[model samples]
Target: MLMTSEWAIILDEVDELSNMILSSEQAHSLRHAYTAVYKDEELAVEIAAFQRMKDHYEDVQRFGKYHPDYHTIMKKIREQKRALDLNERVAALKIAENDYQDLLDEVSLLIGRSVSDAVKVPVSNPFFASSGSCGTGCGTGGGCSCSS
Candidate 1:
């Protein structure tokens, strides 16, 4: 391996971007939203109940409804899950998360495409699909040859 000045510069720029992102307003918003949700008394109760019900539900699932507690566990799990999912704090947290994720994804997509169209950047949005792939199956039977 050899250290190149160009690589060093790239690494520095990456660090700069990383620092900017960590201190960005969206990052702060996300953190605040997460903390708000985490400290909500109602959400905490719902989350705990859901977790406990889910654990029991999973155990009953292994027995395929034949377990004595299957239906009760399943019903409780669904109720708790619905309550949690429909909570206002959880909704705000999800919005904050999506905003933060979008910002990160945009930066990654810009960097990836700037380097080459072949570079793949995973994103939540589907319209930005990149070209190239991890593999191309060895064509037709075995008679094919790729030019080097």
Candidate 2:
């Protein structure tokens, strides 16, 4: 006969643990298509491992909830739930790191393309001179204005 408080705590912990596992799975899916410089695959593997741990904890919780010694079992389940919470935090951190790296890669690519275009454009091009100077005085304060 579990107390109401104990049952409430158990249900809360179970919900939290389930949410963590689902979040980790989503992160893993994101990493599957990622081929950035960061080791997203490794992070995905770690997330998967944590998800498995959460699942194992869930199984223990289910079994313990039905045991005759409900109080003791509930306590153990709470501890396991706490561990699952910690693992979820780790997975979240990994996901954040991977996302940041992906963003960095995208920015780098954009910058690289811009730089490449700048280098390829000839200096005689009026559009390049105007655009680069922002309509400011070009080539020494409008000293050499291109009127072509």
Candidate 3:
């Protein structure tokens, strides 16, 4: 039976540990994506090892039920889960930001290509003749021809 203060401390530590794991996982995934882009097998292996450590931490929490500090540990585990949930929300936001940045890049490329294509085409002004007179009569020097 753990004292209330001791249990509180344990729970706090568990929450902190959980936050650490979640933050590490998020960083790992981001780095993994970046490394995969560069085809870095060594970094991939390192990331896998980190993932295994995270799994081991989860296993420790699961088997904590058999320990004398079961209640305290379980409470801590629940707090950890809450911390993980918050981490996931943050990771999602980062992913969304990346996606938005990619979209902007694509749109910028498309606009550049479109503008280039447009520049390649010949533009015609229907109101201007080869003699540089306006077709609209006002500037044609025809004295605004009208029958009314």
Candidate 4:
């Protein structure tokens, strides 16, 4: 069984590994590269159009059920959503985020498993015998059950 001090050593190692430069750099680079690839002209235009349609839909809804522009605004909103969906950059960004998330999740699970496995019941006192009291009186010369 691992003692408390042994468990502490495992936890300390996990913390050190989490803080290492390589892991930090990989996470940072994955995020930065993903964002850099997403900052494109067409994707921005689609995003803006989607936002505009969303706002227009909201404004039209205020005019009640018979508002003349309600159906047209709703249709435009759906089309804008589709446009955004069709953009390849959006898909790439999602993939990148998912990949990074998977890596992070794996690391977290490993740490949790290791820490759980390291825990143990406290050790019995070194000086005390399991059967009864401590010291030379335990099992010598009629002091206890043992035959000398």
Candidate 2 displacement at residue 20 in angstroms: 29
Assess candidate 2 and give its lDDT: 0.51
lDDT of 1: 0.75
For candidate 1, lDDT tens digit of each residue in 1-148? 6889999998999899999998998899899998998798877877777777788888899997789988888778887777877888888888989889878877877787789866656666444332231123334453333211
In model 4, which range of ten residues has the least summed lDDT?
121-130
- Index of the highest-TM-score prediction: 1
How good is model 2 by TM-score?
0.23
Clashes of each: 0, 0, 0, 0
Candidate lDDT (C-alpha), each: 0.75, 0.51, 0.48, 0.61
> What is candidate 3's lDDT per residue for 29-64, written digit by digit as tens?
666655443365554454455456556556666776
Q: By the lDDT metric, which is better: model 2 or model 4? A: 4
User: Top model by lDDT, which number?
Assistant: 1
Q: Give lDDT for model 4.
A: 0.61
Candidate 1's C-alpha runs over 4 A off are: 127-148
Using lDDT as the measure, what is the rank order of every candidate, best first? 1, 4, 2, 3
Steric clash pairs (candidate 2): none
State residue 132's C-alpha deviation in candidate 3, in Å. 56
